[model samples]
Structure formats: C-alpha cells, structure tokens
Target: MTLPAVLRSAAYPYRANSLNLFRLILAAAVLFAHSWYIAGRGTGPSLQGENLGGWAVAGFFVLSGFLITRSRLRSTPGDYLLHRVARIYPAFVVVLVVTAAVFAPIALLVETGSLQGYLTTPVTPLQYMWGNLPLEIQHYNIGATLQSVPYPGAWNGSLWTLFYEFLCYLVVWVLGFLAVVRRSPVVVGALFLVSVAVYAALGVAQRGGLDESFALFARLLPFFLGGSAVFYLVERWGTNLIFGVASLAAAVGLIAAIPHWGGQVAAPCLAYGLLSLSAVIPQPGWIAKNDISYGFYIYAWPVQQLTVLFGGAQWGMIVYLAITVVVTAAFAWLSWVLVERPVMLAIRERRAKGSTRSEQLPGDIQPAAGT
Candidate 1:
C-alpha cells in the first residue's frame, strides 16, 4: 500500500504518538550532549551519556523515512516533493541565513583577536560561514589545519548532520519512486544496502584507518538503515506485541554496544536504538501534546555557541543541565513560532489546494493508477 493510504488505513495513528514523545526526549538528549561539547567535556562518563545525541538524530532519520515514505505512497511524486520541500526548506534557509549574516560575524569577532581577521584571513571566514550553510556541504578543515576561517570557532558542530539528512531525503525519494514503479520492495532495499556499503567504504577510506572510518559510518548510513528497518516492520506486520518486543531488543542492543565503539562511531547505533524504543513505548503526556524534537535539534547548537561566546563556565553536571534546558526551551519556542509552524501551515495549504484542483478535474482526464 502507498504511504498515504496506509496512513488513512486507520490501523495505527495512535501508535505514532509514542514515537513523538521519543523524538522530544531524544532532542533533549542531543542538547545535553552538545552542551557538554560546548563546555569542553570531551571525555569521561558524563560525556559518554551525552552520546545519546547520535541516537536522537538516528531516531529523526527513522521518523523521516517512515513519514516520507508513507506520504509518497499516498500522493503523486510532484506533490510529495513539494510538501517535503515546504516543510523543511523555509526554516532551514532562515536558520542558515541568520547564522551566516548575524551569528557568523559575532562568532568571528569573539574567536579571532580582531574583526579585521574575519575579512583578511581566508581560513577564518570560511569556517565561520561553513556552519551557516544549510547542509555543511563544504568541509571546514583540510589536512591538519582549518581550510576556512573558524568563526564560532567551537560552535554549531551539530549542523554537520543536516548534510547527511538532506542526502537521505533524496535517496528515499528516488528509491520510493523506483519501488512504486517496479512494485518490488526487494529492489529498493537492495539499492539502499548497496548505497550504505559504498558510503561506509568511502568513510573508511577518507579517514585512513578502521577506527576513524567507523565514526563516519556511525554518523551516516547505520542510523538511516535503522529507520528503514522500522518502516519495513511497521508496514509489513502492523503495530503488534511481537514486533514491539523485537524493536525493544534492538534498541537495548544498540545502546549497550554504543559505548564500546568509541569516539563518534557509537553515535548512530545509540540513535537507532533510542528511536526504536520510542516506536514501541507509550507517549508521555508532555511530549504527546507538544513534541519539540525538531525545534530542540536545530536550536541547540546555535544557543550553545552563543552561550560559549558569553564565557559560560564549565561546572558540574547540574549546572550544565540547567543551562541546556534554558537554552533549548527558548530556541524550541522560537523554532515552533517562527520556523516549524509557518512552514508546515503553508505546505498543508498548498497540498489542500492541489488536492481540490485534482478532484475538480474531469474523471476521464485522470490517468489509470494502481499501487
């Protein structure tokens, strides 16, 4: 069944509420982790727990896969793309522009000794603006030194993940189209696996060793695949006790194994497990009503960057947690009001208009369709 029909199937709408809560929690986890990074706590048990950020990002991937695939199944490809673009790009571009024009200058002034360095030194400006781009497509550092200017020198690191995310959307769109046309899940799955393998190999090669490569692998493909697995299970079996238990098991395994992987290599696995767990668990009252994962994820890095610039000190865990909550909540509100809500409403309106137009068209003009 196509994703739209599956959603309209009335078999599992409530089940997704649990996943929404999971997303909000995961967003908090990511904020905590990034806060630790900002505080320069790069090692030890405190930071180890913070590794859950990877799990949160992975959960987002899974959510995206499930939701996007479902939508594609229901709508025409053009409509699907339009909806997805509207939902993601407006907020993303706004954030990107703000980070570049406003935050980048401020960060550069703080990091370098003088504002003159921002204009004069090529490296400094490049690094500062690199974080401003939506996807972080340009690598900031080359070899032992930063190739671009390092504005917000130690900030906005989480923006790196968006690159992988945009790529995932494209991959899903192409694979989904192929699946719809070919009527073969096996073919789509096989293509996805091959892409993952190739990217994993490239990550290994670029890093020059297994240990380094593993970190890249953890960041990209595994989390996405984990999400794909969730879509497959939910679509094929429906929401049931058995599949829920298996998802729980997978989540536990991933969490337990993440610490062993070391460095960033453990991140994706942690994300996969947490996301799986969310799928199975019941929604908490707070998050069920106001899920803010997307807000949390996008806002945390910039907030931390600003905090660090203001000389926020590294203290105990409690202090860090307090600061993180304050910053995350503030950004979450902004994201909801300025970014998420407006864009979502616009997309829905456009989709509704398109649907009305299609319905108004003559029945004889419609093409024969099947799924």
Candidate 2:
C-alpha cells in the first residue's frame, strides 16, 4: 500500500510498520540516556529539561496510548485485562525473582564482602521479591548492592517507570470500561485539554526548577491522548507526506519558541510525526520478528550499574555504554525467546480454546437411535 493509504487506515498500527523498530530504538535510547547518569558522568543531555531517556519514555507512552486504546476497543474487559497481564507480568515477575534471589545477593556479597550480612539483611530475598512484585512502591535499592559504584546504591533505575506504565494501562482500562474511549475525538480531545491545563499549572509552579515528578503526568498524558486521537481520527486526519513535514516543522518551531510547554503544545504534532515516520520508514524483516525492546528496557539499568561496579564510573561513556549494551542485549534476547514469547503464545492458545468452547451450542448432543 502507498504510504498515505497506510496512514489513513485505522488498522495501520497493527499492520507492518516500523513501529517495532521505533520501539527498539527508543529502548536503546533509554539505555544510552542512562549511560551518563549511571556512570556518574553528569545529568546528561535533555530537551526542555527532559533527558533523552525521559523523551524516549514519553514516546513509549504515546505509542502505547495509540495501540492499547485500539486493543481495548476490540476486546471485552476480561480479555483486555488478561492480555495486559500476560504482556506485562510473566517476564517482569521472572526478572524480579531472579534479581532478588540471585543477583542481589551476589551483588551484596561482592560489594560488602559479607554473605552473612546479605543473608541476614532485612531487605533480602523475601522482601525484595515480594515487595517489588504486585507493585513497584517498594525498596528500589537492595541492601549494599552496587553501593561502591559512583552512582552509589541504586539497583534498577528503569523500574520506576513500570509503575507509571502499569498505571497508564489501568487508566486506559477504566476509560474503556466507562465508555469514555468510545467517544473518540471528543473524549480524547477533552482529555488532551485537561492534560495541557495541568501541565501548564505545574510548569508555572516549577518555573524556578523542574522536578521529574512535578509535571510528569501532565506532560505524558497529553502525548498519550494525542496518539489516541490520531488513531481515532486517522481516516479524517490521516498522515500524508505534507502533513508529516508540517507537523515536524510545527513541533520544532514550538519547542524552539516555547521550551517550557512546547512538548505538550506540540504533542499532537509529535504523535503525527511518530506515526508517519514509523509508517514511511523502511526496515529489515528481522526488526519485526524478535522484539527484545521490553527486555532491554527492564534489564539495561542493572547491567549499566554492574558495569559501573566493575569498570568504575570514571570510565568514559563509550566504554560503559559499549559493555552495558552488549550484556543487556544478550539478556534481552534470552528474555524474548525463553520467557516472553512462550508465555504470550501459551496465553493466546488458552484464550483461543476458551473462545471455541464458548462458541459451542448448548444441548446439542444427539441421543442413540435405538433408544
């Protein structure tokens, strides 16, 4: 199909687009973005006070909004919830368990030179495993792990966003249940407006400085809603070359002119740019086959921290990033093949069987002819 034709379709997100590659790149960007901080280099480069990691994460949220909203619309609540759980939990739980039980203890022993202390610590295996699972509002730092690193004592910096990502999933579920998502342009437009208002208020409040939390929800929700709006109205406001170029220009102009609220102001345009770029960009077949992005995202920070622990943070970002990327990508590949893909396939098979059973006619059994 032509690029414009692809963009105009509501089904485009589910089709063969470069979105998978985009996600992989974004995941890599997050790893790269964290290289400096985790290596204790500096705060790192940012746009409008948000780092590359932050921007990449925001892009993730936008893409999630577009795709997940479409998913919710196509599914019943039970199916939707099941899909969400299947997508998120299997790999996540395994990682948490492995990290808590094996890696944390090893790190603690290595750093503190006391297996006894690691075993006896209050924040050891049980606490770390259980607390981090179910919800991420628990101890982010395991006891004495990576404490000697220049960044000092943070185990998984990438995990904090998972909490919010899950929260966004819940938000989409609730909106879908409420029939708000059905309203499409109207509801999504209003949501975008509300997000903008909240963002503006927070920006004014934090004019002197920018806290990651201060305008986070305000900033992210709009991008997400923008994506939703695009999906809902793609047939009417379809992506074309002219539209894509214009939107990109608009985003650039807005950001350059109004750095404080430019991202929010240009969110719709940004969403359009992302969607168009993904649609138009040519990618290799393998880009769509093995999706290791999620694994990379969840695994990169700890690997980077380990790199700092072994190599020392004073090593340039080049060495740290090189080591971290290689290790993390290996782990990510294993995660996709071993854990994620298998679990997802199992869930889909179960759902298909359940659907088949449900479709059977009741009381359709035949009696014996002789009787």
Candidate 3:
C-alpha cells in the first residue's frame, strides 16, 4: 500500500495497541529524570516548567484516563471497581511491604551496621506498610534509612504519584456511576473546558480553601479529562493520517505556546499524538503481552535509592542509570510475574468463568440433577 493509505489506516487493534510501550518509555523517562537527584547532580531536564518525570506523569495520566474511561464505560460498576482495585492495589501493597521489610532494612543495616531498633523506629516497617497501604504515602523514610543519601529521608518518591493516579481512577468511577460519561458529549466537553479554564486561571498554583493535594488534583484534572475527551473524540471522528498529523501539530504548538497550562491544555492532542505514534511503532512481543510498566514505575525510585546506598551512583550517570534500570527492571519483572499479573489473570479467569456460567444459565440451571 501507499504511504498515504498507510497513514489513513486505523487498522491497528485498539484493544491491543503498543500503548504499554508508550507507558514503559514514560516510566523510563521518570527514572532518567530522577537520576540526577539520585546521583546528587540535581534536576535532570525540563520543559514548560515541568520536568521530564512530570511530563511523563502527565502522559501517564492522559493515557490512563483514556484507557480507564473506556474500561469504565463498558463495565458494570462492580466489575469496574473490582478491576481497578485489583489492577493497582495488590502490587502497591506488596511494594510497600517489600520496601519496609526488604529495602529499608538493608539500607538501615548498611547505614548503621545493625537493625537494632529498627522495628520500633518512627515510621517502622509495620508503619510503612500500613501507612501507605491506604494508597497515601504518609511516611517517606523507614527508620532513618535514607539519612545519608543526597535526596535523604525519601525511600520512594515515585509512590506518591500512585495516590493521585488512584484518585483519578476514583473520579472516573464517580463519573461512571453518575452515568455522566454516557449521557452527553456536550456535558463532558463543557466540564473539560471548565477544568481547563480554571487551570489556566489558576496557573500552576492553587488558591482559596482548597488544600494542597486537592489543588494539585485540580491541576492534574485537565490532563485526565483531556484523555477522556480523546476517547470520545476518537470514537466520533476516528484516527487517520490527517487527524494524526493535525493533532500532533496542535499538541506541539499548544504545549509550546501556552506556558504553565500548555500541557493540561494540549493533553488530548498529546494523548492522540502518542496514540497515533503507537499505531505505527511496534513494541517487542514480550512487552506487548506483559505490562510491567507499573512494576517498573513503582520500583524505580526505591531501587535508585538502594543503588545510591551501594555506591552505584559513584560510577557516573550512565553507569548509575544502567544499574538502576537493570535492577529496577528485575524487580518490576518479579512484581509483574509474581504479584500484578497473577491478580489480573485471576480476575480475568473469574470473569471468564462467570461469563460461561451466565451463558449456561436459566435452562442450563434445570433443577440440578434431575430434580
């Protein structure tokens, strides 16, 4: 086929796109952005006042909003909640525990040469697990474990984002429950515009009675909504070469021109731009099938912290980053294979069985054994 025909084709399977690879790249971006801090080098890079990790996170939220909105729409409320909970919670809890028990203790013993008062320390291992189990990171360090590092006292900087990410999920849940997402495009569009307007009016900071976290949420909301808008917008207009080019151009222009609010404003277009790219970009078969991005993300900061403790950062940026990636990827793989995948697979198996039973119902229920 011709280039024009290829560009026009939306033949990429929407359900099985390489968006996971996009997410993996974003995850890697976060690690790269954080490397400077881990290496005691300071902030790595920035654009439009947001760092690489920040932009990657926005991409994450945007992609999540698109996919999660789609998931919510097709699923029952119970199923939606269950799927969301299962997808995020298990790995999260496991990570919290592993950090407190495994990573923190190792750091503590290396730092002080003993775990002698480890359990009773403020934000103890138990505290770390229980404190963050609710999906909010109430404590950063576990027992003075990170005092000697450059970015001291923070065991895991990455986990904090998970809180906001899950909050975004809850927002979708509420919208789904209210039937707002299904009712009208006008309402959702207007809501998105209003959010953008507020974000533009507020800039990067928040005012009024809104607490910091909620204010931060307001800032992030536009990206999520922008992603949601993409789902509907794409459903209505479809993705093609012209659409892809136009959106990509719009994304670049808006993100570059708008300042402070550019990312939030250009979010839908950015998401679509990436989606278009994903269609053309082929991910490896391994990564395409198993999504270890979440695993990669959750473990990166802590793994970097561990690396720093072990003097890995002294090897310079390239070596440090390679070590962090290699170690974190292993942890991510374990988390995926051992924790995340099993829960999700179980959920799928349960769903399949339920579907089978439902299909075999009414007549198939026929009074059991000749009753």
Candidate 4:
C-alpha cells in the first residue's frame, strides 16, 4: 500500500513500526523527570502545562490501552489472561525476590548492625512478597531498603504505577470478555465518557477528600479508555493526516484551556498525539528490534537511587540524568536479554509446542513489545 493508504488503514499492521523505540524514549523521559527529586533537587519544569513524569506515564497508559485492547480482540479470555500474567508477573516476581533476598537485607543491615535484627523485623521476605499482591501493594520498604539515600525509604517509587497498569489490563480483559470492547464499540466509547466523568469527579474530590494516588488513578483511567476509543476510531474512520493534525490541535487546545482537573481533557489529546506521531514518523530500525522500556521503567528508580547513594545527590541534574541513562539502559538491556525475553520465549515456546502454529493474534504486542 501507498504511505497515505497505510496511514488510513486500521489494519496496517504497525508491528513493523517504531513503538518499541517510542516507549523507550517515554521510559527515559520518566527517569529524566524523576532525577530532580531523587537527586534532592526540588520539582522540575513541566512541559506544555503538564508534569513530565505524569505526561510520560499517561502516554504509557494510552499506548497500553491502544495495544492491549487490540490484543484482547483476537484472544480468548484464557489466552488473554495468560498473556498478561506471563508478561507482567515473571519479571515482577524476579524483581521482588531480588529486592527482598538481596537488596532489603543489605539495606537493613546498613540501618541496624545485625542481619539477625533484619530477620527479626516484622516485614519478612514473605510479607514483602505477599503485600504487593493482587494489585496496589504498599510493600515498599523491607526494613529500610534505600533508607540511607536522599529519596530514602522507597526502594522503587516507580512501582506504584505497575499496580495501576495491571489494573488497566484487567479492566481491558474483563471488558473484552464481556464483549464491551469487541461487540459494542459504542459501549467502549461510552466508557470513555464515563471515565471522563469519573476523572472530573475525582478532580473535585482531590481538592478536598480523595487520596492523591486515588486521584491519580481516576485521572489516568480516562486516558486508558481514550486509547481504546482511538482503536475504534481507526477502525471506523481509518487513520489520516487530517485527523492526526486535528488531534494534535485539539491536544494543544486542551493543554491551554483545561490545565487543571488532572489532565481530564489532555488524556485523549495525548493518545491522539502519540498515534499521530507514530503514523507520521518513521521508527528507527535498531530501536524497533528490541523492547527494553519495561526493564527501564522498573529499574530506573532503584538505579537512580543507587547513583545518588554512591555519587552524591549534589550532582547536577544533567550529570545525574546522564549517569542514570547509561546505567539504567545497561540494566534494561540485561533485563530484556536475561529475564523478560527468555521467560516470554519459554512461555510462547511451551504454548507453541502444544499447538501447530502460533496462537497469538495479529498485531498483538508480545511481552517483548516496549511498554
């Protein structure tokens, strides 16, 4: 197909595109945004009236909703659930185990003079693992992990979002299983509207009553749903330069007009902006080849903390960010090659052995797909 024709085709099969690189950049953006506070600096600058980290995270959800919803359409509930579990849990479990068995003990011993004392603490390794379960686990400090650092106590501040990411995945799965997404595109669209209403309500409550995390989730849910809506929009209207331009324009307008309400208007605009950019830009070959965004996201905070511990938080933000990028990227590459990629391959291979051909649907982002 011609370039314009591909742009307008809902089934253009963009698995060949640069989503992996795009997501890696988003992950790096989060790391960059977090450097300020982690390095004992105050809040950093915002971009186009939104916090950079917040914007990067919302972009993640938008991309996830777009991709995962697409995956759901071509999967049985069993396969869909399995794919999610394989994708999220293995690396997560590995990180948790390492944190508990390795990092936590070291940190606790640093805090107290005794490993025995660390063991005697109430937060056992088992509790540490168990507490971060089902979803929304607050098992952050296993007896003072990273307690000596600038951003002390929180081993991984980035973790809280994974819970929400999984929650959004489950929402998509449940909605998909119920045919709310597949059989009734209108229902999915309506849910987007409902999400906006919830976001608005939470925005009001955040000023007076709601917890900040709760408010954040409420604010982000609309973006996830908005991504799903975009999938249907592509299916119905197909992608086009005109629509892409309009989406970008609308996003700019929203950022200017509704700078409050925790990005209620900005979410859909972000989704469209992401999609439009992908549509218009050519993804680099090397970036599209390997998916390291997940590893980067999960590992960046801890690595940054470690940097602060060793190098001192007095380092300038640029130096901190520069050091962090090099270290975190190395760790992320290792994670992809050693943990995430291998586990996913084993799962896929095991499943493949049972069947004659690959069971995954077209355009279903595999576990290796960035974010």
After superposition on all CA atoms, what RMSD does each candidate show versus the true structure?
8.6, 9.2, 7.5, 3.7
Specify the poorest-scoring 10-residue window by lDDT in model 2.
362-371
Q: CA lDDT, every prediction? A: 0.52, 0.69, 0.77, 0.71
How many pairs collide in each candidate, listed in order? Answer: 12, 0, 0, 0
Instruction: Write down the TM-score for model 4.
Output: 0.86
Candidate 4 lDDT trough over 10 residues, lowest sum: 362-371
Residue 190 error, candidate 2, Å: 0.6
- The true-versus-predicted C-alpha distance at residue 299 of model 3, in Å, is 0.1
lDDT of 4 by residue, 1-371 (tens): 45655345443345555567678888988888888888878767785556678778877888787778877786667767777887777777777777778767766565665677565566667777788765466777676456667678776777777777777778888898674557667887788888888776765777777797777677677878888877877656555656667776777677666645545556666676677677657766766656778888878877788778766456677787888899888888877788877877786777777643324532253332222
Candidate 2 contains a number of clashing pairs equal to 0
lDDT of each residue in 1-371, candidate 3, tens digit only: 46666555464357556777888888999999988987799888988877788888888877777777777677777777777778788888888889887999899988999998899978788887888888777888888788898999998888777777777777777887665568656666677788888877773345565566776677788887888888787666556656767887997798889887888888888878777777667888998767778888989999999899999999899999999999988998998899977887787778886742112111111000000
- lDDT value, candidate 2, whole model: 0.69
Ranking by TM-score: 3, 4, 2, 1
The TM-score obtained by model 1 is 0.70
Report the Cα lDDT for candidate 4.
0.71
RMSD of 1: 8.6
TM-score of each: 0.70, 0.85, 0.90, 0.86
What candidate 4 gets wrong by more than 4 Å, as runs, is: 1-11, 47-50, 105-116, 122-126, 203-214, 354-371
TM-score of 3: 0.90
Candidate 1 lDDT at 364 equals 11
Worst 10 residues of 3 by lDDT: 362-371
lDDT per residue as tens, model 2, 1-43: 4655534434343456777677778888999898887777787
Residue pairs that clash (backbone atoms under 3 angstroms), model 3: none
